[model samples]
Target: MAQVASLFTLFTHHAKTFRDLVYSLRNSLLKTGVFTNEKVAEQQVVSVINFDIHLRRDADGHRYIERITECVPVEQEAGYPETFRHKTTTEEKMTAFMETMLEYFRRSTDRPLYVARNVIEYRDGSYVAVHPLSERSRKEIAACLAGPDQAAFEAFLAVHWGDSDEN
Candidate 1:
C-alpha cells in the first residue's frame, strides 16, 4: 500500500507539473498574440495524452521514454491570397506559437516533478478522479520545488496512501 501511495503521489506531482507547463506555454503564446485575444482569455487550452511505461534491460541497463502532448488548433490550408494580410499574420503567428510551445515542453523535462514519474501508471481507468491536488500535497510539492526533497516526499506519500488503503 505504501508503494502504491508513493506511486500515486509521484504521479500527482507530475500531473500538476505538466498542467502548469501547458499553462505557461499557453500564456506565453496568448500574451504575444499567437492565439486570438478573445480565445486566449475566454477559451481554455486543453491537454490530453496517452502515456506508457516499460521495463527493459540493455548494455546501459533500463531506460524510459516519456512523452507529453498538447492539442491546439491550426489551419491546414497551404496557399493563401497574395493580398491577405490577415492570413499572413496568422501563419506567422502559428509558426511562433509552435516554436514557443516546443521550447516550453522541452524545459518541462528538466523539472523533477515531470521527470520523476518513473513509478507511475497511466493506464486507462486507473485514475481515482480526486481533486487535482490536495492542499497538503500542494504545499509539500511546492516545498520540494524550492529545496528538492523528492525522495522524502515520495516516502511521505507512501505513508499517506497506505493509511487510506487500510481504511
Candidate 2:
C-alpha cells in the first residue's frame, strides 16, 4: 500500500471499550473548561475521535491489535419534523414545542448519544474486518479520495460493503 503521510497521533489508554474512552475525553473537556455543557462536550469528543485502536498482549509476550472501533456520530435530527414558525396560535405553538421536547426526551431515554462499533477485530491470530463502514462514513471517505483513486475505492466498497451505485 502507498503511504500518505499526515499527522498521525497515537497514545496508549486502558479503556476497555470505546464508550469508556469517549466518556473520559468528554469529562476531560469539561474539567479543563473547554466546554461547560456535558452534552456538548460529549458530542465534541464523539465527532473528534473517529477511531479507537485497542491492543492486547498474549501470554507469549507478543502484543497485537485487539480491535479497531469506528465512532459513528449520531445524526442530531430536529426533534419534530414540523416547524413551529408558521403556527400563529399560542396553543398551537405550545403544543409543537412540547412535542419537540418530548421527542428529544424519548431519544435520550431510548438511544445513546452516539454509537461505537468494531469495524476490525483480531480473531484466530489474524486481523479481520468485522463490520462495514456506515453509508455516511463511506461517503465521507469517497469525498476524500482523489479522482485517480476513486475507481479503485469504489471497487473496494463493492467487495466489502456490497455497495457500488450510491458511493
Candidate 3:
C-alpha cells in the first residue's frame, strides 16, 4: 500500500511537470507567432502529447506502474471551416513539439522514480521497499543487499532494524 502511495505521489509530480512543460511551450510559440492565438496553441498542446499513468500491484505483492499511455491528436485537413489553423505549417510545429517532448522524457526518466514496471521488473536484484525510506536510505539498502555475504546482510539488519546480537 505504501509503495502504491509513493508511486501515486511520483506520478502526480511528473504529471504536473508534463503539464507545465506543455503550457510553457504554448506560451513560447504564441510569443513567436507560430500560433495564431492562445486557444489554438492550447488545443495543439492537448492534442499533441498527453500522458496517462496508472498504478498497479502484481499478484506477488509488488506494486508498480501498470501503464503510461502517450496519446497524440489526429491530423485533419486544413480546408475545414471552424477548425483551428496554425500560423505556421503543422509539420514544423509538430517537429518542434516532438523534440521538446523527447527532451522532457529523457530528463524525467533519469530519475529512478520515473521508471516503468517493464524495465524495473526485469532488473537484476530489483525489489520495492514497503517502508518509507528516503532515496539515500533506499540506495544504501540496495547496496547492503548486493554485498557478497552474510556479514553484509547482518550489517543491513543492524543498521535498518537495530537487530544486533546484543538485542
Give the per-residue lDDT of model 3 (tens digit) for 96-127.
66766665675445422121111112223354
Winning candidate number (TM-score): 2
Candidate 1 local lDDT, residue 153: 61
Question: In angstroms, how far off is 103's CA in candidate 1?
Answer: 37
Q: Which is superior by TM-score, 1 or 2?
A: 2
**Weakest ten-residue segment in model 1 by summed lDDT:** 110-119
Q: Could you tally the backbone clashes for each prediction? A: 0, 0, 0
- List model 2 lDDT by residue over 1-167, tens digit each: 01135333466678888888988988988999969988888887776676789988999999999998888887787446465666889999888878777877887766467778787799998877667777777777778889878778878766765653431
Q: Quick one: best lDDT, which candidate? A: 2
Q: Which of candidates 2 and 3 is the stronger one according to lDDT?
A: 2
Better of 1 and 2 by lDDT: 2
Candidate 2 CA-lDDT value: 0.76
- Which residue pairs show collisions in model 1? none
For each candidate, what is the lDDT? 0.39, 0.76, 0.46
Residue 166's lDDT in candidate 3: 22
